[model samples]
Each structure stands twice: as structure tokens, then as C-alpha cells.
Target: MPDMFCFQCEQTAGGTGCQGRAGVCGKKANTATLQDELTGALIGLARTAMNSTPTAETHKTVIEGLFTTITNVSFDDEAIECQIAKTEAAKQAMAPQCSSCASKCVRNDNYDMQNLWTDNEDIRSLKSLILFGIRGMAAYAYHALVLGYTDDEVNLFFYKALAAIGEELDADTLLALVMETGNVNLKCMELLDRANTETYGTPEPTKVTMNIEAGPFIVVSGHDLYDLHLLLEQTKGKGINIYTHGEMLPAHAYPALKAYPHLKGNFGTAWQNQQKEFDGLPAPVLFTTNCLMPVKQSYSDRIFTTEVVAYPEMVHIDEDKDFTPVINKALELGGYRELHPMTGINGGDTLTTGFARGTVLSVADKVIDAVKAGAIKHFFLVGGCDGARPGRNYYTDFVKQTPKDTIILTLACGKYRFNDLDLGEIGGLPRIMDMGQCNDAYSAIQVAIALAGAFECGVNELPLTLVLSWYEQKAVCILLSLLALGIKNIYLGPTLPAFVSPNILNVLVEKFGISPISTPEADLKKILG
Candidate 1:
């Protein structure tokens, strides 16, 4: 067998998979093997949980283990191995009698991951959708878990789906579970939405600056708002400033989070540019979650990882979540010499976020009036993950070419493409509205459903067109949610998943009318027409 095989992300090597000494994401072969082993152990734990009673720790460990294997999350073999040991221990505690039995059965053994990889193509495709979709959902679940929120339905589905991956299932059964993954993920996203809004307050439209104040400051990235909130609270009176990066940008929208006087502003662009953006930076960068690129020597010492994100030689904040190392590093770095300024990819000095469902629906009457008055002709939900792919420019161009009478609702890191562009407004609202982070795709769905309700039509009949760019499994789950909701005519790009078999692609196309994005002009013309 090859040393490694990973094609979970959109940029998998040569559009097949990365099977060699290293993955395209810089994950080494040994690290990949350990991840597979960790996955196998997680399967065993979940399999054992089917026949025995498991604790809250079992669900949390399964969520963390699935999330750890996500792209750009962790590349530390030691950490992955540690996670494996923990999974084994969890399994042992759950079914100790099975291990000490005089007659051994294969009921409690870890599922060999390679078996699924080499399974029948259609079965693999359907199961991959379920597996990858849950992997993405676990991220949202993990974030909620940290905020002291738990949903039994969502947690229970984790076992069902993980166990299903290890079973001999047919296409019809697996496909149903695949769509159910989407259905359950919708609830999971809603659960997370409630957790975030209740804890941090509903996000309001907030303008975040791009300038770095002259002093000791730290740039916090990734999707974990709880970590950012804790860091913001701890650094409040210390004279150290805080700036958000990547998916953390939407933290500015939440009332409780933005109230931090020292929570200065945004620092950089999307996650893919971190290596270049953080090269030789004066301040330290703390990652609370995924999208952590390989550490570069230029600023290796400045990277501090917490939660599931880990890398070799980086200072990892443990369960205590004590950020003293990161804080002291910021003190040592002392930040910039003067007021250092930065701009977005579009050279805009400021970025606006927090146009979540609550905020947008607050103006629903005006939006409805605009549509009735023919002032807003169409709506485009252009959002998803951003990456280093060259074809991602299609999103920027597609957004730029949108007609003036249309409205664009975007979320997630993909908005960094054209968010800074002033798309103008209709009925006293900006044409382009950011609806929080990727998890906020729920907000977009809400807005669409509201519009459909206002017009007495189905969501599929609304003027909204979903043009998505996916880079990771989070996008996978979101896509499944949309498909499960029966929304159609969605456009996905820059490239489709390498794990999708030809028959499965045929199924998605025939059932949902899923389209691969072409050129911006061509796609825009087709979508408009």
C-alpha cells in the first residue's frame, strides 16, 4: 500500500489524492498513517459504544478525533498518537469484559481504515459523503462543546455515522444516511448558532479596521470564538492589543466579543495566506482551530496553537487554555515600530461583517419591498472556503460582474475575495452583506426561507442562487445540508472533490442539478439567464 492517501480537500494532489511520502497539505506520511489509525480507533470506540454505555467523554473524543483529521488542522504525529491512545483507553473502559474474554470475537476491534478506502466505488462515494460531512459537522459541534453546549441528537448521530462507515452498507442505504447527515447537520448548525448568539449576543453589523496599533498585540485566527473570548478577557488590562484573523473576523459582530476595548481589529486575509502574511511578523499568532498551515521558520516561534490545532515545536495551549506563553511572546515581540497599516486583497482599508440572519431579517420588510418594486432582481449566496487554488479568482470576478440590481449574501473565508468591493446598496442596504462565518450558512438559509415565505413560494423558487467555493470538509457538510433542504441549481468550484466517484457525481447532478462553476462571465450569464 502507499504511504499515505488523502483526498478529503478540494486541492488534493492532481485531483486524485495525495499518496506518497507527504500530502499536498504538508502532512507527512507517518502523520497521515497515525491519523488513519486514530480514525480506526475512533471507529472502534464508537462501535463499542453501540453495545455498551459510553460517557460524555466518548462523544467529545469522537468529535475531536474526527476534527483533528481535517485539512490544515494538526500535523503533529505525537499529538495524533496521543489521541489514538486516548481513544483506545476510552474503548477499554467501555468494554473491559470483551478484552478479557476467554473466547475472542472481532466485535471490539478497530476497523481497518484501508478497507473503506478500497471498497466498492459507489459504496465508498456514498460513505465518503457521510464521513466527510460528519467530520465537518464535528467542527461546529466542538465549538459549541467548548461553550458548554450539547445536543443529544447531534451527539448521537456521530456514533451512528461513524459506525455506518465501518459497516457493509449498500448505495441506497448509504445515500439515505448521507442525506440524513445533512439533515442532522442542519440541527447541529442551528445548535451552534444558538450557543454563539446566546453566549456572545447576536452579531450586529460592525466595521472592523485593518490597521495594527503600535504596541504589543496578538493575532488570533481560526473559528473558536470561546478561545478568542477567553484571550480577550485575559488580555483586557495588560496593554496588549488583540486582532482577529481568518474565520475569527466575524467575532467582531457579536456584542459580548466586540465589547473588548483591547480587541482592536482584523489583522490579515483568509487562512491560505497565513504563511506569507505571518512571515517575520512582529507579533505572535494564536490559532484556536483549523486552517493552520505548516510552520515556516521565519515566524515559527510566533505560532501558538490551542484546542485541536497543533504543529511540531509550536507552543500549544493545553486544557487550561492558559495563554500566558502567547501573551508573553507578544510582550517580547513588542509589535510594530509605529502605527502599521494593512489593507484587504482589494486594497480596501476597512471590512464590514455581522450581517447575520437577525440583522438581515430585521430589515426583511424593506428587502421584501425592494423585491416587489423590482429594485432587487436576483439574490446570490456566494460563500464557502477559500484556498490557494488559482481558479478561486472566479469568485472575485463572478461577484464583480453581478448586476447592480442584485444582492449578494456571502459568508465564510471565501468572502475575502470580493468583500472589500463596494457593491452599492438597494433599499438602503449594501448590495453585498456578510453573514458571519461558515457556520453562519444557517443564517443564509434562514434569509432564503424567510424570503420564500414572504413570497408564498418554496425556497427553491426564490431568486437566490448559491455559488460556492469549497476547500475543506466544512463545505462538504454545508453542501449536504443544502441538498437535504431540496435547494437546487447550486454552483460549486474551483474544483470538485476528488473522492466523488463518477456514479455518485451522476447521482448528485441528476437529483439536485448541481453544476460545476465555469468562467465568471459564463457562469454569471447562465445564472442570470
Candidate 2:
């Protein structure tokens, strides 16, 4: 009879966890309960698979189940219920003997999320880290899997991590697992990087216009390139233009994808602005992954979702990838009449991307020379997800206040806040470099390691700072990976996670020097001083 509890995102109620009729992400209480049931069932399946050998199907189930519960991924109770059924079926097949056991030991059973939700504060915080971290990592893994890649270690760890969540482990034990989640996520991210680069050639630097061309068009959002590829192939020569939106903006940098003649330009800003950007647009928007906000009535008819993304009553494109319905919708809408001019949040008409690790490191000698010559004083990796919170403007102000002599590398939706601002260039490199999507944090990490190697110093010793904004689980896992690598002095905002207990927060501050962001002026002064 009471409302469900959820605070896994920055938009949680009042800077605390959301404990109300619906999540700030627009997830209803019934949907939240179904997601919890799906999670619990996945845990039960993991417990069963811990004793039995896991099949590829087992790993796939674990990945999809976790990904389904990620904030903003799914809002359909039926889809989550279907996942729960599949999880239960997998458990039954894996350990049929347990069902008939006379003893009621309950060795492997579904974990009531309420237990972890109501556990001791510290334990809850630690377990939440492992759970949320895996949920985020699962998204990356799912993407890679769709592209024909998977790591056995990463897959098995999902079972181990889920089982640990159901255990009454001590603080130290859970803490170790929490850190292990981060360490494993780094490997998972690496696997995804390889999958992406190998599938679509290493991204090259390219400029993307924000203007949407006239005529019928479909806007593709989210991070799945394979889906984009299929859609492009299907729509080729159909008089329909395709444009990237949200995290898909970087898809234009892929040599294979960019070659598509009709894959026009980007349509909208970040994912948070979709409702406003897509409203009454004479085009269909296809969501291939997370960061989908609740659809509004104004644009509901033009919305189509594929893969794990779902909303009640919206048309879903299945794995077959037949996008005819979407194409038809686009044709029906017929797009803008004249050449419709669209600008980014910064009022700029174009954005540049593809500054991934490969591209950046290719010009490493020039960058090092510039730094040595005092042409470039510092580097700031100011990137993460963008949210509806007003404090998120801090990222905009931080980049605006950064000295011209510094380079700001950004990724994910957060870059939308200032991607269009002309920060000028340093040594032929734009002062503000867009680094693909959030998973391209892999690219950023690679660049950092290379720079440290070039300077013969540790990453922390380099004249570089990481100021990140968190909104969802992917940010959680990425932060853990940084901490796991002993990278410190990171500034995080708009606020600390509500799930972090006070003692755990102290440990993070004392051990890692993690600091919540202050005013852009003060933080910039502290960093640049």
C-alpha cells in the first residue's frame, strides 16, 4: 500500500531517494515494484547458476535483467514481468533438484529488495554500490553483446555480484566486492571498446551540423550503432534523411557509418530536452537505449523504441530491425517545410566530435609540445550525463570559466550543455573536444594513461583534472573504475549520491580526495591556482 523507494539517480526526490508514487524519472510505483520483482528474480537465477555451469543464455539473461532495471531504461511493467518469468525459468532449468528438496534451507532464493533497502546504513550503501555498479556495467555489456562480443569473466562476475547482494556479508567483504565491481567494469568497458572499434572502425575527428535538412526524416537517439546501421541501410534511397540525437551524435564519426549518404545531421540537443525538441516535429524519433524520458502526448505518436527501451503503448521495433513502421511514420510526418534551422543549447549551428583516444593520441606529440611551450596550461575532462537539475549549469559555467589555455574534453549528454560554444582552438585542436559517448570514457582513460606515460608521471600527477556529473548508473561504474585505478582528486556534482552513507562518504573523501563541486568560480580557482 506504501509507495516504492528509489533514489538511484540525481533527480531523486529532494536530493534524497525517491519514496513516493512515482520516480522523478516518471516511473510509476507499479513499474518500480515490477522492476524490483525482476531484480529479485534475477538474483534467484544467479544463485542457482552459481552452483551450475552458466551457459551463454544464462549470461544473456543476467545482462538483460540488470539492464532492464537501470533508471530510465524501461517503463513497461509487462516487459519487466516478462524478464522476471525468463529469470525464473532459467533458475528452474539450471537447478531443478532444488525445487524438490525436502529440506527448507532456502539456499538459493529470490532476495527481497526490501532487505537491502532496509539494511544497516553502511551495508546498504556498500551493497547499493555493487548493485548499481553492475546495473550500469550490464548496459555496456549488452551493447557489446549485440555487436558480437562478450567476456567470460565479466559474465560470470554478474552472477557472483548478484549472489553477493543476497548474502549477509560483512562490511569489509561487501566493500571488497564493491571495488571488484569497479575493477571488473573496467574490463567490461575495455571489451566494449574493442567491440565498438572493431565493428565500426576507430572514430575519426569530424564536424556535425546541428541543422536538420528539409524533407521527411527520422531522428535516432541513444548509443546503439548497430541499430543505427540497420536503420540507415533500410532507409537508404528512400527519400528519408536520418539524423543523430543524444549520445548517437558520435555515430557520425565512425567511418563506416558516416559513409551513409543520407545519414544527415544531428536533430536535437541532449536526451533531457527530447520532449521539447521532438514536440510536434514532423519526424519519428527512435530510441535505441537508455536516457529516454517519459514521452509527452505532443510527441507520443512520433516515438518509436527498440532494444531494451520501452514505454507503455508506444510502438517497439523488435530485434528483426524492420523499421518500416518508423519509416512510414517519418514519411507521414513529412518533416519541416523549408530548410529548418536548429541550433544547440549554446546557439551554435554545428558541433564537433570523434576526439576519441585514438584521434587524440594520434596528435600526442603536438599536444605535449604545446604543453611544454606553455601554449596549453592544463586539461579538464569535464563530462558525464546531463540532467534536468538546475545545478547542472555548473558544468556550463565551469567550461565557460576555464582559461583559454586549457583544453576541455567532454563526452556523454553533458557535453550538450556547452558543445556548441566556440572555445577556439589550441595547437589545431579545439579547446573543447567532444569525446563520443559516456562509454568513450574508455577513450578518455586511455588518453590519460598515454599522457601519463608520455610525461613519465602518474595520472594524478599530470596537469589534468576530472570534473564529472552523475545522473545514472553508468556514471556510477565509471567513477568506480577511476577510483579502482587510484585516480583521485576528482570533482563530482551536482550533488553527492543520496545512497552513499555518511561514513562511506567520509571514507571516499579521506581516501580518494573526492569533493562535491562548489561554484564554478571557486572550483576553477582551486584547480587552476
Candidate 3:
């Protein structure tokens, strides 16, 4: 009668695995169990696909099945059950003879998560890396798939990685697979970047306001741009405004998305504050993906979910993406009677984003010149998911304490900590540049590699530091991508991942120079000095 165990995220209990009736991410025990079943079925399908050629349907099923189990993606037991059945169906299609054969072999049987959870600590750590890393990578893949972009190699690796998870592999073998997960994730992120920029024009620098204009409006949250685009199209001339929330904030920078006048400014702050911020709002909130907290009664009636994101009793918009219900709800709410002024956590009334790789690289000459002239002393990439942990303020403080001569390139929701704060400009560039969403970490890496090439050195030799704050599985895969690229000396906080064993942690520290973040003042001195 014990609870499920999950430690793939940074918010795990006591800096260890979440071992209770529910996950700290608001995932109930039943939902967690169903997620485990879905994952197990996916592993079985992978085991089957390892021998047989996988179809495009098989690849899509593997990507979605893995993405569904990521932290906060699916909360509906029914939805997860559907995923489990689909995975089993895919397995049967690939290995049709296994089920009907008189001689039954368990070679491709589903894996019980408990085995990996209770395995040798080091083995568990390594396997967790492959499992959770892919779980995060799957999100990027899902996003790309929706945009009509697919990579066969990325798809094949999902099967290879999941099959390895179910196998009784040695530590070294699993460890190698763990690194491969990182390598594969880098490619996945790149595929996503290409998909997004091609579908929507490359992101450019644009400033967003925090004020909610008077009128009916719908606030869209999550990482799905396609959902936002569909909503914008459906809501055109309907007198309903659309506001981006959380990861959707970066949509403002996309020329195609910004062309829709109804896509107004962002609303609320980071995902963690939704319960408090959404209370009694005059608008409906549509969630397209993860980072959904347990809904409170105060605003649960106004919450809607689409795609993989779900909550019991909340209205769900199916694949057809007909958002009439959401639009009607927005019209009913009618939003605030007059303009409502809003501010970021730092009390800034405006937010700036769109400093994606295209924008940054376009001004490469200015940046290189600034650095050579000592106008920019250092470059800090301070970004990741923003969680409820008290220590997360370290990001805000870290950005605040960074020298005036330094440039801060931020991405993901973590930038919400101090994004609105005007850090002034260096060489005609804002001191802190918003670099789009978490997957846009691809953009940041591109900038780093470009800079290294400009300086005629490796990325590690460049004057750049990655001070990251992680909350979910996406952050896990991003960290892996960095390590896989041989980028080192990353300052990670507010805490280390609970799934990382002591020996594994030691290996990371010694090999990658990964360090847990300290006080902003101390860490600043260490990095600057």
C-alpha cells in the first residue's frame, strides 16, 4: 500500500525521490500508477520495435507515450489509460506473434518501474538518466511532430533508449546510453528549433506589456504555438483578446504570431503562481501542455485543457483544436471592465523577449566588439524553470548581482524571476536578453558555439557561464545536452537532482565541473574571479 516513487524533477521530497500518495507536482497516486503503466507499455513496444522496423505510427506513439509521463503533462487517469492501451496495441502490431504463441517468453514484457526504482542505487541513477532524459526530450519531439517535422534518427533513439531501460544492462552500458540520451536530445532540440522558426518566422526582439487590456480575453499557457495560432485564428474579429502565459510568453516575438492583434500581452507570472493568480479572474485559461498545478475551486471552473494536459472534470479541447468553447467562455467572462495594470515579480510593467539565436547572431559583430573592448566583461546564461522553492530567488539575485559589464542571456520560465527588471544596455543590447522558451536552449548553444568560433577557441574557453535553475524533466534534458556537448563548469541550483547518486554526482562534478549554486554574492565572486 505504499505510494509511487518519482524523483525525476527538482522538487522531489527532501531532495530525494517523491515517495508518497502523490507527487509534489500534484500528480495523484493513481495518475502516477497509470503513467508507470504507460511507460512500461512503451518499453515493451520498444523491445518489440528493436527487432522489427517501426512505422511512423509506432514512432509517434513512442514519442507521445514518453511525453505523457513527463512531470505535469497528464493528470487524467483515463487519458493515461488510453496511452497505455495504444502502446500495447503498437507492441502487438510490431510483434503480433508474441501474444498468440504457445511458448511465452518475457523478453519483450513490460517493465515494472519498481525494478528500476529499487535497483542498485548507481544503476537506478544511470537508468533514471536515460528514462527521465528521454521523457524530457520527448516533449521537444512532440512539439516538432505537431509542426509537421519528424526525424527518423530521433524517433529510432526513443525505441533504443526505452528498450535499454527495460534491459538488465550493466552500469557502464546504461551510463553510455545516458550520454547518448543527451546527444540525441541535442538533435531533438535542433529539430524543434528548425520546425518552429520555419513555421513561424525566426524570433526577433520585441517588448511585451504586462497590462491586461479591458475586454474579453483568453489566456493560453504551455509550449504549443500551434494551439495558440489556431486560437488566434478562431478568435479573430470575435472581440476576444488572447494573452500568453508561462512558456507561451515568447510567442510575442514570432512575427507570424505577433501579426495577430488579438494576441495581447502576457498575463500573470511563472507557472507556480497560477493557483493564486488565476483566482477569480474574468477570463478563461487554456492549457496546451505541462506545468499545470492542481486547480483550486476559486478558478477551476475557468480552466480548460488541450492535447496531453488534462484535469478531472475540466473541459478538454480535442485534437480537432476547435476552441469555440474556450472562446465562448472568454466572451462570457468579458474580462476586466477597464484596463488592469500588471507587473512582473520584480514590479516591472513591461517584459522584453525575442532575443532568440537569430537575433543574437545577427548582432554578433556588436557583441564580439563589446567583449574585445572590455565593455562586456562576462556572459551569463541564467535560466531554467521557476519553481516554488525559496532558494529559487538565487536566480533573481544572481542576475541582479551580475556586473554591469556582463550580459545575461536567459530562457525558459526561470527568466520570470527578473526578466522585467531593466538591467540597462551594453553596446546597444539589453543587459539581459530573453532567449525564448526552454527548447530555445538550442538557440543559446548556437550563440555559444558561434562566439567560440569568433574567438578562435572552444566553448569552454569562451567567457560564458551557465547558471541554471531546474524544476522539471525538460530542464534535465537541457542539462544533459550541455554536458553532452562538453560544455562544463555549469552552476546548477536551487538544488541538485535527487535521482543522481553520490558516485554519479561525484562523476558529474569531477568531469563536468557541475556545482550546486550558493548565495548569489558568493557564486558571483567565484564566477567573476
Candidate 4:
């Protein structure tokens, strides 16, 4: 028997599962168990929600618990245990009689996750899909909730899907729930889309530098734009320059965020490169959400975590949202003495982002004209979470080999693979257009729909291909959303998910025409043909 069981990520051990003392993502067995416990408690809460009316706080707790279990999010056992206790209190408040029932029915109890882990293989696989999908959706929901945006249907679905995890449902029923999870997630993503655009204004095309100006600075990583906005406000005129790291890079495209002169340019490349990039760094790095790697001693003291992204011994910014500690660390480090220039994988000094649906649709006529005139061959959405795994270079090579006439639209950190490359322009629009962060997949879908309308055809009929590289559960929900929309022929890699049993994989392949990526040349030939 193994000490832990975690195979929710693409980089799971042996391409099957992780069951040793630690996972490939550096999560220890004890911490993994605690996360499982927290998830189990959330399940109990979900079961209670089905019976009684749930408060807004109840929905937030469920989202928080699910988001905390995502890969590379929370590694602090204490934080997770605290979350578990909070979940228990919420459940008890909802069903107070269950605590003192003399019947000993064992109902309304925190489920033992081991049951799901040890269930029938096919059954377990289907349930895992629902479990992981909602876990990913929860991150998006948490972001929206923080911004004061949410959908009742989306919140209600969380409880429904979670309760299903604790039930002994048939494969057909569970599978239907899996697709429903995807469908509801689409609504969740849209809610977040509205919250972001309406709150901060629609994003516009903007260029971000890779070079670092000398002086005290702070690097904000993860996906919380509100956290970055607060830091930008608190540090206004404080002489401390701020830079976006990883998924936060898209912040530069927002008119409101871009208005901050001290926001500066991006720092480092992707989440996977943090250990090497932040080593002995003279500045503090504030993590607002996921993709937080295990801190190294060289820069652990300089790391600060806010919201649900926690690691042991790091200074965690409480709900108060006060960034005084992070700001002070930046001042203490004092940054580099001279201009420090940084280039991306392709040796380019600048990266461009903010080509969301509105921006793309604004130029729909030009895109249609180029396609009709044969100047543009096709559109490839090469996006998803980037990770520290081999074979990921496939994305870079895949993008590089694309026909000069075609356009590469990307989002999320995976763009770091070749985003720096000067792919040049076609019809005044760059060959490569970055839509936004992972959640901004909503933007990509909207662009596809508009293009389909322009061509007087279904989205499947458009000359568009989705080549996605996934790493975490957030990728799972996005893939589900794509499936729910009847989007077909998605080519996923560097490897298929371990949580996806052979049986489930077949369902995706047969129904959706989904294929695993082979190589740049081979996939290009197949897609182009």
C-alpha cells in the first residue's frame, strides 16, 4: 500500500499515479492526505447544502476548499487543516442535529476519500473527472467571488457535483454529471469574464518588457488581478517597481492596471522556472494563487503568499489584503544596481498580450479577408498551463513550424515556450495573438464563434485547431468546457492525464475526435490536411 494517492495532474508519477511518500509536484504524503481530508469535508458540506438553504459564505467555503486542493496551490498542512475545521463548522451549522443524533446513522459526516480512491476503476475514473473538474472551476469561482461577481446556477452546481462525488452513482449518471460540470463551468468562466472586464475595463493589446529597471521591486505571480491592483495602489509613488510573473503577465493589458506607471514589466518566464529564476533574488515575490513551487532556501524568506496559495514558513498575507510585508521586503532587497535585461526562450526582449475576443472581433473583417484571400491558412489555439516536464518543447516547435500564413492565438503561461519569438505580422495583426490568462479561454471561445459566424459555418467548420498543453486541474475544467461546447478535434499533450482511465479516454476520442499530439510536423500535416 502507498502512503498517498494523487494523480490529478498531467505530470503524475510514471504517467499513471503518485503513491509514494511524495508527488511529482513535491507535495508530501501527509500534506496530500490533509488536502484529501479537506476535500472530504467539502463533500460533507455539499451534501448538507442539498438539504438546507446554503448561505453565501457556504458557497465561498466550498470554492475555497476545492481551490486549495489544486496542484501547486497550498502545501501548508496547517492551512489545509484550518480549512477542514472551517468546513466542519459550516456543515454543523447547516445540520446541527446530525452532531448530537443518538441514532449513530453516520450520515452528514466528512467522507473518507479512501473509499473513492479504492472504488471500482471505471467508477473511480468517472467520479475523478467530476471531482477534478469542479476543483478547477472553484479557482475561477473564487477569483470572481473576490471581485464581487458570481452566478447562482454556478454556485448551486458546485454542491450538486460535489454531492455526486460522495454518492454510489452508475457510470452513465456520473458521466452525465461530468459533462454537466463542464457546461456549468462555462457559465462560471463567463461570470468571471464579466467581473473582470466590467471591473477593470476590457483588455487592449499592450507590449510588456522583459528587462528590469534598477531599484527596489516586487514580482507578483499567479492569477489574482485584484491583488495586483491593490499592490499597485498601495505602492503608488513608493518608488518600488512591480512586475507580473507567470499568469499575472496578462495584467499589463488591462487599461486600469496598465495605467500604473510603477507596475513596470514582467519578471522571469513561467511558474516552473521560479526555483532558478528567483534564486538569491534581491526582491520579494508575492503569490496570489496557484502554480506556487516549493520554496527554496535561497529565496524562501523573500516569498509571500496571499489567499489560498500557501507554503510552510512563508509569510502569508491574511484576508486583510495588507501588502506591507511584501512591500517592505522589496525595499530591503533594493533590486539590481543596474539595468538587468532578460529575454524569453526565443531570445526576445518583449512580450505582447491582451488580444481578447473584443480585440479579435474588432478585426474580424481583416481576418476573414485574409482567410478568403488565402493570406491566412488556419488558426491554432496553442494554450494551457505550462509545467516543468519534458516533451513540453513540443509546444514551441509546434508554434514555430506553423505556416507563415496561419495565425497562432495563445493564452496562459504556455506561451512562454515561444512567445518571445518575432513571428512577424500578417495584414497588420501579429501572427501570434495572446488572448489572456487560462480563465481567459472564454475569450478564445468567443473569437472562434465570431469567426464561425463570419464564415457562415459552424465552429467545427472553421479552419481552427485547438492544441492544448495541460498541467493541472484548471486545465481539466477548461477541457471539459470545450467538450461541453461540442468543440471537436482538440489535440492535447505532452501527455494524456493519468486520472483519465483507458475507458474514459476512449469516450473522449470516439465522441469528440480528440487525439494525443504526436509531433510538430506530424500534427501540422494532420491538422492542415
For each of the candidates, the C-alpha root-mean-square deviation to the true structure, in angstroms, is 1.0, 0.9, 0.9, 1.0
Off by over 4 Å in 3: none
In candidate 1, stretches whose alpha carbon ends up further than 4 angstroms from where it belongs are none
TM-score of 1: 0.99
TM-score of each: 0.99, 0.99, 0.99, 0.99
lDDT of 4 by residue, 484-503 (tens): 99999999999998878898
* Superposition error at 75 for model 4 (Å): 0.7
- Model 4 misplaced regions, further than 4 Å: none
What TM-score would candidate 3 get against the native? 0.99
How far residue 266's Cα lies from its native spot in candidate 1, in Å, is 0.5
Candidate 3 residue-pair clash tally = 0
lDDT of 2 by residue, 70-110 (tens): 99889998888888998888898888888889986676799
Candidate 4 lDDT at 112 equals 89
Tell me, by lDDT, which candidate is best.
Answer: 4
